[model samples]
Target: MTEPAADSRTELSSLLHDLHLISSEKPLPPPPLPPITELLARLKEKLIGASSDSETSSLIGHVERLFQTADPDWLFSLTSVNEEGRQEELQAAYRSLVCALIGCADLPLCGDECSSLTPAAYQSVPIRAVPVCSALRALLGALGNWEETGLLWSVAPPVCVFAVTHFQDQVWTNPPSRAAARSLQEALLRAGGWRDSTHLLVGDGRQREEGEEGGKSRGILGGVLDVLQPQLTKDSWQRCEAVKLVFAWTLLQLARPSLSPHLPRLLPPPLLFNDHYRPENCMLGARCLHHIILNTPAADLRQFNRAEVVYEALFKHLYSTETTVIQLVLSCLLDLLLVLEKPPSSLDPSSGRRKPCRHDDLLRLVLIHMEAENKVALRRVYASVLPLLVDRMGVAVCRHLRRVERVVLGYLEVKDPPEETNRLKVLEVLQRMTRAAWPRMQRRRLHMLLRRLLQLMDDVSSDSQLDDLIRDKLMSQTTLCIKLLHDCSPGNAQTLLLQVDSSCCSPEVLGCLETVTMSTER
Candidate 1:
């Protein structure tokens, strides 16, 4: 045998002998094993030099046995001969073991710049020699036991990065490896609290440039982002679902202020996904964007027209036929609009006339769509979102009232079965619009709206398909709509209702009006 092979055999035999002694001793003072750092270093060197599958398997078997037999407390316990020296030694040993196991598992740790072997190169290693799933199982076992020693936190950041990078990746094709990775992730998170855990995952954002301290302290998130950013191109992100999912998972764990600092690194992936041709990707991207909009401060999103860029991306989705995509886009646009321009103040009617903004543009588009929309599901979605848009528009809803009137009239006339979800939402919009733009709810408009609402009550009362609960709800909402119209344009709605020909309306419809008037009196 070559000299190096002889040395490797000698080292392996010594490690096995130590493990046997440690396992056999039932007494307190077991024979001392080699320092952990030296022991794991030797093991890593042997694994790297392993020439055949049998050698690799034998080495891995020894590792699994060591983890199973060694007592964690004894392994990490400080020696009295050099307590301070031993503490540092133990920490280094812990870091070494983690790094060794992660390498043996063939998981990517750093990108090409930081590592001697890039991910692509790591992929070239023989699977039998590396045994990725087995390494991950052994690593998880070590981490699970080490967690009780409290030494796990010292080495958590790298393990966290590995977990996240490996999390749901296509490279981890083995089901057992995937499960092992997931368990390791939960173990790390439990060892580190969520905020602190995510903090480590995102890193401090102060990554040093190359050649500076060898770029050793680049934040975990920054490093991952660097690797991921290049993969977020138009053609690339579609194939990078795992990358998108990881970014979404991390972004959701953070909120405003905390999330603001990382926006530059965090924003690109979702935008690419948002612009994808697939509906599922589009929806996922929109959800990520929505979380960003809700959690980020208005001022941060407004910087450098960031809000406008997001608005344009989401605005195009308004034309999407996918209900889920449209829903997410509408929600994202609503919150984003607040960043672009403040909501029109109801306290000042003049605010409505102050130059049209994107809110008007969006509402105009929605109204045009609503005017022609034929799908019941879409009508319900539009109806449900309309009230929120009007609330955001405040008195500015008056600008779209001409179209709003058309939408309300058309939507109310349609029969939304099982539950009048669309009609109910339209009534809510009408009530809010009346309160915001009471002055516009008048003259012929008031007469037309009141007549349609009375007709609706009659229509609802006569429809046998509606249950008692739905009928009552429809009558009550119709009553509230008329009551708001009357409240907004005092005396006019009541006068119009009173002047209605008795033969034109049913007694139930008329009773609903009576109920509104009575409630108004009270």
Candidate 2:
């Protein structure tokens, strides 16, 4: 290829310099060129061999002018090079374009550019072939890398986690390499946290840890946790936004890896075991924690080997002499179990489903631990865990009730009928479990449990004179009971109908109950 003339090269250099200056300082206005149709015509002429070399230079200069000015209107001109055979040069140009774009804050190019690039355009850009495109692709790949890297190397554990929350599918499908993942993790770590007044991915990496002024190498998890705890309280939404990145990081980490055994060292111990009566805290923490246990097929849980550690760690909280800790552990445990039960494929025999594969053992251990607590404690745990357990094990959890004994049931039986709310809750759980177990159930226990739940439903409806909240609760329970009864097969319903009468509840409640009972009897 013949070298370009010095004059042309000098002009190109000067134009690039000027563009950079404009991009750096005051915004450069759009290229002082012809209208879009004219610009397209010029570009078309160049592509179809109609325009001369000078005309091609002019077209490039016009694009440079747009880059200098940071004009969104100039964005349309980018389509000029969006033709076939020019991709190699265009992709190279786009990198410099993006880098320059990142420097121009006034145009807000990142957000706008992200929107303008369609999925087709994203596919067209061979990110692997070009530097600028590669960088952008690297950023995209980092989202997936963050979590798996955490599991594999114990690096960028925080950012790796949060990235999973926002881009789990991306991470699961195509994970980046360990090195690329680490770099991306650091970029996110530096970008996601706060510094005085900014929420950024890259900035002055100086930040306070839990409001204290010091730079400790506490790892990504600690740094993020430190930055987040401050923002969680009242009247600090900006801080909250910054902290959200940390939560996002946590969720992302969860998507790929089990919680590191060392994560507790990063966060306050109390957060792991929140106060149970304070449903707000328990709910928030439990829900935040639920993502960790969610069905993520790509996640590698065997890397951390935390089940035994978690079981040992949480056992104290579960059997704690203190009521609050016990409550929090129960709430957290229920969430953990729910995640375990879903997407049956995760439990496939050959899928590297971790060491503690016998989930039944875990449940048995938990039951044994909670036995020493009072019925109130047992009731609290049962209520939170019941929904999930019923959904998964169905009536299986309640089977062989006599062979497996817990001390809490002793107090459970002694409670007066007036305090039957706990019993009602247990029955609701059993009823749902039985329904889920459906055809899998043995006829005898199913019949007995259905009869017991039917009587409990009657007890609830008859107590209409109770407090308004309790009365509303009982009525709702009655509705659920009727729905379950109607769903049961005629033979099963008929078997129970002979033993439990619907007349135990008020006439109004019994009226609807009679229709269900008679329909099932038929």
Candidate 3:
């Protein structure tokens, strides 16, 4: 407790505080996108202007040294220590190194330089001219090339995957060098993502005989799978985000058909399949799969059971708080359904063409999303979920129908359709569900859902989008309801028409009414 000792302790504490020794889960605003052009220029200058060949070799050696020396965890820790502004400075430096190694701005390798150089000399030799076009292709193609086991470049997939999935807007804006980027990306994939289960690697022999497909994978991808399995399987929520982000990027890259054959590890269920039920997780899963399915070729979707898994997970998350995770899940699912109608490559073989899992969960999730307090969130959820729901219906479907009834019944019934574009989605889903499952649906349940839709039509004001959607829904439902009514009791046609009249009173509702009337008469 001497004064000198106390002063020393205080100074040390201050230094520690300044260094950000403490960890924080509170999300920091994401680092700004790397300044691709500036970083590329610096890298080009560094490579092209070395005083001697020895110095140039030293620079390349420095690049390699970074991989060996830099501790990713240590760098992550520093992020918390620095102020937001200072953190940006650190990130800028980090990005410069990444761009330089990845070859963001290509150097010209012409004459004897590209052709005459030996392997070691070639690696050290600097390209003087810019190769932006080649660099861009390399950057995009990098994902496919990422490998883990080969040389130093193989590890680039995980890093690139991390960058592209999380900071895609920035990474794509101004990549350094296409050829180098591709080489790095492929190296990363080969190094990390390809390896998964012994089954995936060794199962190839058996899988070939069974004709079950998409099972073999290798390289950095394999390493990534090995690394992620423990983190995902455990309840490591924080670690899971890292795994998921990388997974998303990998999915984005492997979406192409040509690349599809190489990605057997991802096709099977990921290790964290159960965790995706959380809203954020679901969102990540949905968005990643959405990108892949849309971008990749259409194959037997039965193999990649992403849709079913997403449906199951989002079903659980639909009721979560209004966070980016929930929104992402909803938006991703919507996009997935809209853009890619089939399952992903990882589907269970037994499920057949129809998704093995029932879609009741998705229906329920959409219902919950519809109830959100935020209009924007709610609308986004509706835009995506509604269409899918319209495509499928069940006993639970009626429950959502009833909920909609309570909300829509209070508004001024509009004649123009209900234009809450999201609701139109609801209507579409309802229509699809009814059309497909009508024969199997219970008589009482079908009647109740139709009544609810009618009530919703009565609640919203006319001519608005909400009203417009309701009207269209009414027209569609009215026809189906009439058909159901006639199926139940042919003698009660007039009575059903009267009920329809009572429910739909406005001019637009009347047009739907007329349709119902015609149907009844027929």
- Reference-based TM-score of each model: 0.72, 0.40, 0.42
Model 2 off-target regions past 4 Å? 1-308, 334-358, 365-378, 394-424, 440-443, 475-479, 482-489, 495-505, 518-522
Q: For model 1, what is the error of residue 260's alpha carbon versus the real structure, in angstroms, after optimal superposition?
A: 1.7
lDDT by residue for model 3 (122-154), tens: 332124112322332333333232222122232
lDDT, residue 349, candidate 2: 66
Backbone clashes, candidate 2: 13
Model 3 off-target regions past 4 Å?
1-168, 171-248, 255-286, 289-316, 327-358, 361-376, 379-418, 429-493, 499-511
lDDT, candidate 1, at 116: 34
Cα RMSD, each candidate: 8.7, 18.6, 19.7
For model 2, the local distance difference test gives 0.40
Quote the lDDT for 290 in model 3. 51
lDDT for each residue of candidate 1 in 196-215, tens digit (9 for 90 to 100): 54565543445456555311
Give the least accurate 10-residue stretch of model 3, judged by summed lDDT: 145-154
User: CA lDDT, every prediction?
Assistant: 0.69, 0.40, 0.43
Best-fitting candidate, scored by TM-score: 1
CA lDDT of 255 in candidate 1? Answer: 71
